[model samples]
Target: MCRVPPLSPRTSPTISWKNCINESDPPNLQCGSIQVPVDYGKPHCEHFNLTFARIKTNGISCLGSLVYNPGGPGGAGSDVVFAHVLKGISVWSAELLAQYDLIGLDPRGTGLSNPMKCDPTIWNQRVSMTPQNEEEFNQLVENNKAFSESCRNLTGPIFDFMDTASAAKDMDMVRRALQEDKLNFLGQSYDSQLGSRYAGLFPQNIGRMVLDGITDVSLPGTAQLLIKSNTYESTLNEFFKWCNTTIQCALINQDAPGIFDKLIGTANTNPIPAPGCSPLSEHPCRSDATSEEILTEVQLGLIGFNGTVSFTGWPALSLGILEASKGNATLLSRPIITTPTSSDFSFLGVACFDCKATSISHIDLLLKRQMTSTLSPHTLGATQTYQAQAQCTGWAAPATNTNHALKPKKIAQLPELLLVNSLWDPSTSIVWANLLREQLLSARLVLRKGAGHTSYFAAGETSRAMDGFLLRGELPEQGTTFKS
Candidate 1:
């Protein structure tokens, strides 16, 4: 197992990147950075940098590098590609790892790439608008508007450059530079979109590609919001059923049902207090933030259905709200996991760019649907509505193709692919997975009875299915469903 290496001075004469023909660094992968154009359209113009990492066998028997992408328009695939591989499952056969060179490419504006960054205060600000009355509702809109504008203003042209189409082109360029005959692709979550788009554009080049956490490849942004909303709302109900069996969930008031209500109620009224570091601010400290910052803090909770924050830290998030309510500012930021990288920005940039929706109408309809349903009331829609609208309306850069979004094309001749979905995936829910499965010519769907976004790496039986496919090129029996 590769232990975390100590921080060392980055040395000169980085490894020369090309298809590996011999065992260059026995069992240890080498990584390096390559400068790519900021705009593929204007390649001779401005240039930004992206880092690529890989591991493979030596002396010419190497088939080619198999490139992998982890989910998250913002997740670091470069980290996963070089160091990790289905860790919990360890299904990547030793032989597979030894023979096929594994490569991870950080898309522009992501890890090690020239990242597009914005002030953390910009995303952390709270919105004072509660919308209990008409004045508050208008203030809510204005609050969202201003927040969006700040993000846009702070993250200008770099935002537009992060789109998926450009990243797909970048992948092709990497393949060429590596001197590979063809590229093998593996993408999860939003990476599925990245991979599939590449397949659509360059299908003949496809080699051993696997797409997990499938998003609705056929739908545009508007329809995608609807699918995920309805899917997760139902999964939430199922989650509560499981929560009812557990003491942790049962100890709270009316069990899962009541806890859900209480959580939303508190969040809606108070928002969460974020006493954390902001990446965007130079001062790196702020004690007083506005309602917009509070809104941003609460917004994070609504975006995912992963494990709950610990009781100790949970209140810190809550305190972030309490302080914001009192007109005190606390900085908000993501818990430091990996070093802040340019790839992170590129991931978010491409996600926003790939989305086709120009207005908030789709989200507005989703919120309405959630409210009308008995299962999702006391849900976290108010903040998300404002969040999506804020990004799309105020901050999101103009779409490259106002008239075009990827439409699902029938690739009916493809072999049956494995589809994995988390039961309560806040972003891509099981329902959406089922919907996408229907369109596939041959596919098997597995529902992870767990609460998380992507199932393959999140943990569960789904990992077994992923391993089976990757190792033997096998697919689960059609309609396979597994519990966590």
Candidate 2:
């Protein structure tokens, strides 16, 4: 039911770009902003400017523009351009750089677009996501409401329109401003969900689109969460297996799963001490890290893409766990900045808006929690996807862009799409990839037989297959699988 505003004379606003002079930014880096309606239904509604950064190709024949969204539902594409791509490190193949203007547009309310706000003091409170009782569930609801209210007070109307549909509309606005017939997109992680939204809305405007680490928007929110919980639980077992055999694994001499179970129990009872943390400090970590924090830490460590990738390895995770057992939980600490100025809080404003919401009575929430626990015994159903759904239980904003199967009439108009996925991706699973492929008209799936959230960063055969599609309009053979 999302209706994009009809194109009019004022649709394509001119973009004025200037050099990005941040110390780390490349010399050719250009940054600009485009204004789009806060609500497309009412085009005259107050507009917000989305920020973008790019490095224009010097080659004579440019392939128009390629927009890359490093999926956070909240990750700043502009930040990725400045920090990695423009630096000539963690870059696209040189030929892509030579042929296209690689642009990164920070979605509305994230990165440079006034970044969404919530009261850090209220957000930092330790409300258990896995509420075991009515009282605990009430606390969770109260915390979410307080945070939502704070956001509404500070962010104004644009906060209500932070959904993916609004964002896809913003992308089309960028396309018009860029004067391109089609937009070439590279969306990772949650961006797959965003890409799907864009395809449904402006299928004709899509050029070459790649949805990596795919999410099946077709699934119900609860179904997605349960499946992800199962994925995490299964991945945790893989980690346990690796730890038991690897000599470098700190838990090699001990039973890894048994130790993790005991640690979770100990944390629930006594909580772990984080001597290196200061809760009041900017970018603060909790001093008394609870079982919730430990479970969250475990997920972060289990981002096990491959042995060669420079992510926190299984050995490091074992070390983090062993250290937490004694006293210090510093190694497990992730600076959870919930301040108004920090983009840390934007995930809620964006993610909840993308979810399909239904009224959940307290009893229903308890049942959902019970189902989550029953499905994921080890992680306790603590994937970010599940936590996001549960947090949206009492969310104040309406879910404008909901999770549903893509319509064939609209999706049929989309050009060929390249769907890339890791077979063992911890967050978005291969199951979602296959389901998403079924929804699209002409799409190919590239499965990397490895571990990790994304396959592109692997920068090997999988990356090349993605590059082949974008650079020369080539599609990988339908069921290509690459070894990590």
Candidate 3:
């Protein structure tokens, strides 16, 4: 613990430091909390206390705090410190760790911060996300609205302000509270959503920022969903190609997509059974899987391999497909658990606030279903983009952070940033990365011609590029496309 970080100044004079809430928190870490307005517009009405964990550099050299966001709009950095960082399992390298204070943030509606809440009883009800008819559509909307009401009744007004924009504004408060002139940041997946909003709000305070797994939030909701659905369909073909060539694949020498399509047809006519399997087991194995659940599971598996995060490899995915084909969906159905609160509602809560879905009637939904399914037959629009929009159908909170083009004037003085993304990222499509490049005019993109959610998750040439840039103010020249 020699040369550990000093006790940092509080985020506010009134705020104070304390031991981390979790018992296994890192030894040399200091945890604290600060109260930000529940609604930025109504700063004085009420507030939410946000908590954070920090670990200082071991070296005498310092480059301010490296603010990290683990992406899920719901991902809590403080939890990450105890769960992953302290265990030597993280994306941050030793060199960057030596010179920066690591700030572990719990966003307003997540982590140890006053979290979003919904009645487990209400949440447990299962209504089809893809309603088949007008009656089913009304049921889905009713359930979603009831779920939203439960969250609002328990989480209060802070529920409405849980969007990425508010979190971005809250990020600036942490920056100023730490007394850093610039906010050095590492944001992955959905974190880019927050980072872009921050850049649009406070460009002059920009520091060396790296946005990995780049998800562009500026696109219209329908466009975003279709783009992601197309990417997933493409990536699924890549997985099928691997199955055809690799001996490890259970479906080797067999027509994988044909078999998959057949399984979907069977599932539609008669749901596949998972004998003696629990729906929400330790690994989330489930029983009676639907065609929709199968695609969702495939989407999770296609997050790819060899990153800091664990993803189901192609071999495992093939085996799962084989299992489901044999009428045993034990391996194919997961994360589509029976209960809603049992799943990560925070992802939906943050997504609903961010998407601000309007009350479209059954007619509009029927068209969306037809359009997306035709656009992506194999995957059937099983992207988070579609899921988020569908889930927010009847949210009660007003949409405060609606999608729009990024303000170029706000980003004019912004420092150059390194935007890293996977060409075949199942979650964040490469198309969005291109659009984001155009949005952040000064930012340079280094496209990794590989598969995975984020490049920085694994320490390769791409991660090293991000590392060098964040540790120092290094970025490639404009129009220089880097591939690894």
Candidate 4:
């Protein structure tokens, strides 16, 4: 159970704001910023700025501003909406651009909202963990240690305070600033957790809400990490299935398993060049084929709200892989960054602050216990283990009461919530969507049978269903799963 910490003693309910309207910025969509208290409990204290953008509805019957968040924990929703989603919406694209205000805010410590900037060089450097020997493995540990230290040293108390719960409070502040009675949440991936938390915190204020590619906040740390590890295995298997069919993939290796082995083997022994020959040196290329680099690239390709967004960038990926197998490291220089964007990282600080911050000692003990058990051999020393361990060790956050992290007792009282999942989503799985549905009890599910993280935007029945749900508060029939 997640317990709410004593609200920061330094927050103001009334948000202050600063606006910059360059009438000449091509007017793609209206954008602005809001200054919210860095701490929510103290209504009359110090404040931090958060940026927000709104795309008003056109002629269609306005159903209140959809306060959309495209889950990053670190991913920028405002940037995504302005650059992609809202930009693609037909009604909002032309006439309704002015009518419907599509709100995008860089939650605290993200984007321009009291942004957290780490040393770019230190933050972007990535060292592969697929070590050639024990020495290399030790080096991998050092790399991780250094990376964690770098983040801690560079970022300040702001980094320590960024968490989803606080961000939810910021969302509420956004609603008030826009003068909306309630919020229509369009949240994906990690953002789903945010949306669910918001609903749990303030069910009465929920307008139409859709949570895509759900995250199960109810799961204990060990179980949640297990699910994430298992997801990687499943998604990689699925990726190989696709790779095996393509002539390029087939020529490389006829079988799915062998393709993986060959890719890993070649990358381990040699440096592959980046894929494209662009003048820019940082772009993906063939010459950068370190097994670690290849693995990172492929993982990024395979994982998302739905597995397909990576596909959009696959040609470059394939080219990079092909070049690497042939021995070129120059082409893959660009993908080596270790730190995630603001979207990829949410409030690790706040997560720790909300629930007691995790510790490496606990993680080490859990990993040791798991290793001694009969759990999958692959489960012992994995990415999720390292991720959780690092955060616990790196962040010196005080834990909030455990109850602060727990889900509420009643979900049926809220509006009919739609839970979207991709059959092949790698980050948050169909299993997670199921878990979320079970928790909400009254919520409906829409399964997109395609590649991607969240399938709402992907082509197929899922897309159609999402369109229907958003346009009209209709939920897909239970047990109805759509294939890509």
* Count of clashes, each model: 33, 2, 0, 80
- Tens-place lDDT digits, model 3, residues 1-484: 2232222334342446777756665566778787777777666567668888887678689887998878876888776665555666664678987889888787888877778777766665656678767888889888888988988888777777888888998888888777788899888888888888888888998988889887887767778778888888888887788777879889999999999999988987677997747744665455678877778878888786542444657678788899889888877765434433322677877888777675377777667767788988888887777777777888887676886467768878887888888778788888888888888988898887777678876677788888889887778665444566
Question: Which ten-residue region of model 4 has the weakest summed lDDT?
Answer: 372-381
- Candidate with top TM-score is 2
Candidates in order, TM-scores: namely 0.70, 0.92, 0.91, 0.79
Candidate 2 segments exceeding 4 Å error: 1-11, 22-25, 85-88, 280-283, 304-313, 357-362
For model 2, which pairs clash?
A: 305-451, 305-452
C-alpha positional error of residue 483 in candidate 1 after TM-score superposition, expressed in Å: 4.2
lDDT at position 360, candidate 4: 37
Candidate 1 on 1-484: residue-level lDDT in tens? 3232221212121235543224554355566565455676666566555667676555356656777767567665656653453233242445557657777767766664555665444344443423344454455555545644544565555556777777787777667666665667767777776765676566545556667776653555545555555554555565456444644332323454564455444544454444554544553544433333433344443333433211122234334433443434353433322233334334446555656434443344344444534434533333332234335443335556332233445354344556777766655666557775665555577766666556655445677677667656777776676775
Q: Cα deviation of 65 in candidate 1 (Å)?
A: 2.0
lDDT of 2 by residue, 1-484 (tens): 4355445755586787866666665666889887778888787657777889987787788898999987767878887777665454565677787788989889888988767877888777778777767778788888888888888888888889888888888888888999888899999988898898899888988999999898775677778778788777877887777777778788887888888887888887788888888866764787777887888878878775343233566678788888887777877865666558565578778888888555355666567657877877778777788678767777887787775657788987878899998876678888888888888868888898767678777788999888888999989889899985
Model 1 superposed RMSD (Cα): 8.9
lDDT for 205 in candidate 1 is 57
Sorted on lDDT, highest at the top, how do the candidates line up?
2, 3, 4, 1
Tens-place lDDT per residue, model 4, 132-202, is 34555455456545644555566654665577777887888777767678787778887888887787787
Residue 404, candidate 1: alpha-carbon lDDT: 29
| RMSD (Å) of each candidate, 1 decimal | 8.9, 3.1, 5.1, 5.6
lDDT against the true structure, per candidate, is: 0.54, 0.79, 0.77, 0.59
TM-score computed on alpha carbons, candidate 2: 0.92
CA lDDT of 337 in candidate 3?
41
Runs in model 3 lying further than 4 Å from the true structure? 1-15, 21-24, 279-285, 307-310, 336-343, 477-484
